[model samples]
Target: MMRRHPSHLRLKPLAKQVIVITGATSGIGLSTARAAAARGAALVLAARNEDALKAVAEDLSSKGAEVAFVAADVGREADVRAIAAVAVSRFGGFDTWVNNAGVTIVGPAEQTSLDDQRRLFDTNYWGVVYGSLAAIDQFQNQAGGGALINVGAGDVALPLQAAFFASKHAVKGFTDALRTELMAAHAPVSVTLIKPSGADTPGKDNARNLTGAPIAHPAGIYATPLVAQAILYAAEHRTRELTVGSGGRLLALASQVAPALTDPLLAIGARLNARIAKAPDPARIDNLHHAGRDLRERSFQPGVRETSLYATAQMKPKTTLGLMAAAALAAGFAFKLGARKAAPIDE
Candidate 1:
């Protein structure tokens, strides 16, 4: 069993807190930055692109937000430390640090080169490690401690993106272990692992696609803001983990309940993913080796869900569960009545 802290923890409100977010130039990171700023939070943003970071800082600053940015890659320890240094220099210190910087490779695990796999780990896994340590050190010395939020994917592994899935699994392990250590020591920090489902972010477009075809998320995709909301909620509240969409929660459940059935379904989904691509881009550029240039948050995918009832349930479990159970019972009763009516009269 995991140990619990002896003391009560208190986190600051968004308007009065200083938040540091890595990978702030685009996607969920950018969306989180925007939402935090809107809530009157002072922001410290980090990303590989200096120009894009500057542009984001300026835009947020124009709206009367106290925003600072550092151009640092989280994969490097020194660079990750620099992000903390700027946060201290600009706003005294940060209340929440989000390790959201990551890159993906869309191809078979065997076909992926050893060098490419290492590079992906450098950004995805090592990046989270470095940021988590940095945030822990700062929080340990501070009065209120802090929130450490790591953006991870759904727990289930996908067929085409093995490397990415492996990295996420590593992140989940690290985050959980760190949370346990913090609790044992009676630390005030709140560590949260955010497992989002297929989000309509630019990640697919930014991925290193070696399959010679356009790639897309194989499952239901939710809007970036849904994930941003979860991140921000973790910033203010203490939660062990939060899944952003119902699809992610369902996949996790299925994987545990029926792995034998789930494996074949995932394989079918992988093949369907390739077929669903409208066309392949001949000049597509991936950010696996370099800084991403695009700053757009949304992928503009059709059928993007704007909200998630499952996500709401994660934040408020008892009430949502009660509502969901009642709805399920009603549906089951209706189905039973319909089946009885359709029975043969001779019976």
Candidate 2:
């Protein structure tokens, strides 16, 4: 549970903020770098790929955005600390840190190797833990507090990617607990979790595919810019959690209200989606062991529609919550009506 803070809290302007982002070479992290830089924020980009980091830094620099790069793996605590160290060295103290580095293993829980599962948690869960701790420490030492944002997936258990979903849930749980602790301590730092639904990114090819099937992000895929928008918003303002897309939002609600129904539905979807009979070469296809350097903007998959549900929901929380509740009520009422029509008439 994210604790809401007073609206009067002061935050530094985007132009003056020194932001550090992990997994900055590609996907949401890369998009976030571009967005934040355009806002005049100084950026420190970190990833395991040195060449890709240089390319991103050069591109941002050419566009006159203050930027630096650190080639480090988020899975290592020392490397994560080095990212903060670079921010201080280049831009003199970081104001916002986005822990966006994560990986996935596409396969059933039984089929996915234990080593692979542990690796997923190391990057998804432990990476956030390490980055948050570093950012909080820096915020405590500084005069003004800062924002710590963790880019997490929707908080729902899905099929085929059991470990990946579990890792995401762990991230949410850890983030909530950290928020509670920070509030109790009266710390000025703000922690936020940004959960984006399926987006068309290289993540499909970037992950370890143990299922021996072609894997891709779920339907209703939105572009990465939408997620970057939410990330930038949370950086300048205080946000508890932001879920980005109607598809993800609906799935989360379904999982919460009807897990029995959603469980099998999700399983069936995953099984059917994994029907592509080709397998990716583990050594060349996966970035689980090392950093991947194929950095690009979008995956460009066909037949998927985009949405702005997340951005709208972020801008209007009360309206969004009310609409979601109204939808639930409408669904219940329709079910009752159908039941009445099916029942034997009293004659």
Candidate 3:
């Protein structure tokens, strides 16, 4: 059983808050940093690339945002601690911490190297563990509790990215367990998990590709900023989890309601992914073992959706649920009326 907090918990507005974001050099983290800074929040950015971190910090600072950068790898517990330490030293303490560093391998589970898989877990799973612990500890000592945001992939797992999906599953489990423990302790902290579908981010480009050909999500690619919006929303709101795309939510629902059918469809989708024809670049340096050079938020994928109604609904669940219920009632009434009209007059 979990106990509620003794009193109401209030989160600071964006302009008055300080945020710490790991993996801030690219993808959702970079986009979130920009969004938060634009909203007048001071930021502490962390990533493996000191130069790129400096560039991002300089850019945000030049725009009149209070920003700091730390070149720390989240895979190492000590380095993760250093990130929190910098937030404490620079901004007195961070109001939110976003664990957004992750890496993936594109291939069959058997084809990928064990070392690579372990390394991916190091950054994805263990990194979240370290960041969550550090943030929780800091929040306990602070005046008001803070938010911990863990970025996870969609709930439905895909074929080629087995290890990556497994890491995300672990992240979800750990986050849930931690949230329960915090509630049991009556702690004034919010833990949120951000589940994003295929997004047009450098992650796919930076992934280790053991497959002979390139790999991408089969469908439903969303813009990186959309995911950033979800993350920032979680920071200010006490959301348990937010799936960034409707496609992802539907797939997750399908898998839960009918895995037998969904499994075969996923297997067929795997075949289509294998036939994409694009070859992996021999010279491209994958970010699994090192930092990626490309720091941009968006990838080259076209037709990236800029918005998600499902994501918007998640932010306002009660109203959305009421609207959905009303629509269902109206549809049922219309169906009955049409059925009566089509029936013969002699009852």
The clash count for each model shown is 0, 0, 0
Angstrom error of the Cα, residue 322, model 3: value is 6.3
Indicate the TM-score of model 1. Answer: 0.91
**Candidate 2 accuracy as lDDT:** 0.84
**Candidate 3 global lDDT:** 0.89
lDDT of 2 by residue, 139-197 (tens): 87776778999988876767777898899889899999998898877777888999888
lDDT of 3 at 330: 100
The better candidate by TM-score, 2 or 3, is 3
Steric clash pairs (candidate 1): none
CA RMSD of each candidate after superposition: 4.4, 6.5, 3.3
What lDDT tens digits, residue by residue, belong to model 1 across residues 1-347? 22235257778999999999999998999999999999999999999999999999999999999999999988899999999999999888999999999999998888999999999999999999999999988988877888999999998988888999999999999999999989888877899999999888888888899887778655478999999999999999998999999998888899999999999998988878777764645676788989999798987867889999889988988898899899999999999999999998985
lDDT of 3 by residue, 234-309 (tens): 8888889999988888898999999999999999988888575345567889999898776889776667899999
Lowest lDDT 10-residue stretch of candidate 3: 1-10
TM-score of each: 0.91, 0.86, 0.91
